[model samples]
Target: MNIDTIELKQQQLTYPQLRKTQQYLMPARLTGNSGQPNGYDIYPVAPLGAGKIFTGFDTLADYIIKTKAVLIDGFGGVFWDKVQQQLQSCFNDKDLSVNWIYTETFLKPTGEIDALVKPFLGADDSVWGTKATFDLIDLFEPAIEQQVPDAKFDINIVIGTGAALAGWASPIIYLDVPKNEIQFRMRARSITNLGNAKVAEPFQMYKRFYFVDWVLLNQHKKNILNRIAVMADAQWPETINWMYQQDLEAGLDQLSRSVLRVRPWFEPGAWGGQWMKEHIDGLNKDVVNLAWSFELIVPENGLVFESDGNLLEVSFDTIMFSNNQHILGKHAARFGDEFPIRFDFLDTYKGGNLSIQCHPALNYIQENFGENITQDETYYILDCDDNANVYLGFQEDIDPSDFRLALEESQETGKAIDIEEYVQIHNAKKHDLFLIPNGTVHSAGAGNLVLEISATPYIFTFKMYDWVRLDLDGKPRPINIEHAFNNLDFSRKGDKVQQELISKPQVIESAPGYQLVHLPTHADHFYDVHRLEFDSSVTVNTDNTCHVLMLVEGQTILLQTADGTQKQFAYAETFVVPAAAGSYKLTNTGSGRAKVIKAFLK
Candidate 1:
């Protein structure tokens, strides 16, 4: 799972010959009618194949009956209560309505768990950090056969199949909401039944929903979602659509030759920047600042494919599962079933500094998080201020033990450590690629717009320091000094860091109007980086490997596929050219020189 392996050693990894030795899985892109003038287009299936591609008057009850499941286990973001009512009315079936069970009924009182987590409310612990597990059987035994919630249990006696318990395996139906909508609903307190509590503050409830529920539960329910019967987009009636998993795979197969872009969601954070809010179109402007944009984050990002002039979104995992080799090529065999590369924005323009953090080494991430790959990442400077500086590795070595003591004392006393004394600083400019392998202490200093390119294992940043800044809610953010110290490589100090970690771009190829610069990374880095400096145009081949493109320094550019199909992207826009897309031509539509960063398997 380490992307570094996917980069250097994956050339030897190859998938079995298609249909030669394995089960023949053909292209099965989902196609549907939207009642428009145009014809049908391929569609992405909902996450876990739990929802449907098209809405109908009556289908939920029939689907349950057809699938031969006693109950329909639907779990998702806020507003499920109201969504259930809407589904009941849509189905118009008393039989189906009477069999559904809301998980809230099966809860032990909130006081027991709340008391344990209360101490770390303003400290450095997440709900998952607590050694507490609430199984459905333990809490919902009393409500098993009762109609307490006005729904009689299906006599088949399928127990606790909703949550991520051992016996929960039926036709799962996952309802989903966008991040913006979920946050809004949580803040508005649209519905109660937050595990154990009836009511809580907005920010507190938000933490439970995101950190506890989503992050901690995603892996638990991934198996159920993998073979889901239906996935609902949760937009009732008009736009609400349920998509099948097989159909989604089929749709992805059909799109092997086309480009794919997920509808990115934006979030405003405590150390957020203003670039996204000022430039990115179709974002909620009411937010104070947009810190992170999940540009190519597959697990969380949703895919959008237009069918008959109507745009429908599904989880990006559809293509990862269905079009594996076609999208990832050789790395597909190495990565098996995961998309290895990630493209995300880190905007610090006119904002504060990011947390000084480091990711665990490969073995640490694997042993601790049960992950196959570590987050091997690189930060390509997309834009930056005149005085922008990036924190990487450490300054000239002093004492590793002393550094740990200083960090701990700062955490205990609410005092800020002088970051420069221990951390190395490098001035950043446009197109400066800083190599941040796992365990390299790094941070995106303020006044720079960074395009973080890496193997997608985000959320593992073990923050050692946060510059003594408070969160958006005015509470001190969490810092993991112990975890950071355990993973920090003091050997990556002063001279070795600059000579090994910091990238130095070399012009590998130069022509009249085009030059390809090789931005060499660390030996452990599984992915390679390159800058396509072009004047008028340049032709780039996928080489049977997926290529992620970013318009780092240009107003706009055109990507022309082999079929002569073309797509234009503006400045700071990120897009992907699939492995099946073959060779594509890039025409610089801007006035001056254009630099597009192409990242893929080495």
Candidate 2:
């Protein structure tokens, strides 16, 4: 491609739909509990892809020459198909022919091409006379044979289903550079399991507990795949016959019995000699030498690089699973197909009683000339100190400007708020439930361990105040005063949260546990809070409903597998079990009382 031609074509490639779609996804307004609706409230699921929407036109073709750029950030179907059809019609003119670009950040193909083209097309690369796009011949045909190793191929495919959109095709594409040669790294996409770790406990260990939901790693010119194979058998817990009930336990327990102490993750020696034989030791030695290892692997946040010396390579992209449209709230894409929304349970080690500041209302933020805000949070106070004081909402009506001044002062002077202005501060107790509507200023006071259930996943935090914890760089983080000020409403004072116990709230003998309405939404906002307490083992048959089981007080075994096979979790630990776990048992194994919170859409 000539630079002169690129400059000329750049101006002609104007994508109008791109601009419109970007605006459509950006969260433009905030929403409140019971207030006037704001005009700018845009609750787009994923707004980061707001910039890449566009289409490519052929410019010259006889019939309805169809070539278009379908930019899908996450999951797209009827909505996108309708948009694609409209674009096809728009570019069907005699003078203009349509060409599809299909631009998508989350899409593996787009990311791969972008990653490959970036280095060669980069300004620094021009000094070496490298071009932007290379043909297949140039990409694979190595300059030397002895320097490179054998290449291995891996492919994974799955069907995507959605409510608003059905039959949406989304597939994972993975390509690994040949091993046993000088290489940068290996990359993969949408990988379900990589049996790289050592799993010795079998049924006694927890599966997918590490939170490494996705992986992309790099190794030197060694059989990295073979290393991975050794790691897999030792890491993941698969099913097998068990003579006793203990055989149905997690593998971690089995390993713990041998090791005497339970460890968080695998120890280096746990890989054993079998794993060491597969060049694992040699690869480990070589990995530290690489200058740069790029694995466009999507972890929690984004891209990461691991190296084992030799040459350097780059990955295409990385995406967090929570943000992954296909598996956002579902156990997996298959379960998500049946249930669109994914209900997640978060156990913040430090977010117990000393909670952060509250967010603003959607209407106030949108109308009052401020940034977009989404604030709807609920908490199940599983445990709290006897004298713990949880402050929430305002005590009395106040001038909005005064509240603004208070926020400004907090931002400038490190003060949270004018303590005098706080509305209803209550001493929160254990087993209490609270509904925090948008715009209400509240925090989970210190020493209060709780289960938080919220509306959306995005973090629209307005730091009213902090315990004054300095950042790693030793700087006080700036607060968004203007936005937080607009959200605070002094008129409505929220009430204390109490467990709704109607003696034996309507019992569902068919269902496992009884639903004790702790805090009703009252106004159908986000979710209905409930406390599920049972003495005997309860059978919960999941029908596409994912649950975040948090053991507050005692140990409970989540019987997931068919028959009696299950994984046991103790207090303070939380598990996001898939609805596919099907009908499982929640057996109490601890000595004392067992308390847990069950949050789902009713």
Best candidate (score: TM-score): 1
Q: What TM-score does model 2 achieve against the real structure?
A: 0.43
Summarize candidate 1's per-residue lDDT along 290-316 as a digit string, tens digits. Answer: 788778777677665443232345556
Per-model TM-score, in order, reads 0.75, 0.43
Compared with the true structure, what per-residue lDDT tens digits does model 2 show for residues 1-602? 00122332332233222211111111112122312111111110111112111112121111123311111211111123333454355454433443332322122343353355344322321111122223322222122111211123111111111110111222111122111010101111111212222222211111221111111122110112211110100000111000111221222222111110111111111001121112111122211121111110011111111111111111111111112222123434432212222222222223332334666576653343222334466655555556555667665554667766666676567655545465456666665656666766676565454455555422355666655555323555445565566666555553322321101123334344433334455352444544455665665654554454455555543444433444555454434444434456677665655666554544
- Model 2 scores worst on lDDT over the 10 consecutive residues at 229-238
Candidate 2 lDDT (Cα, 0 to 1): 0.32
Give all candidates' CA lDDT scores. Answer: 0.64, 0.32
Model 2 residue 346 distance off true place after TM-score fit, in angstroms:
8.9
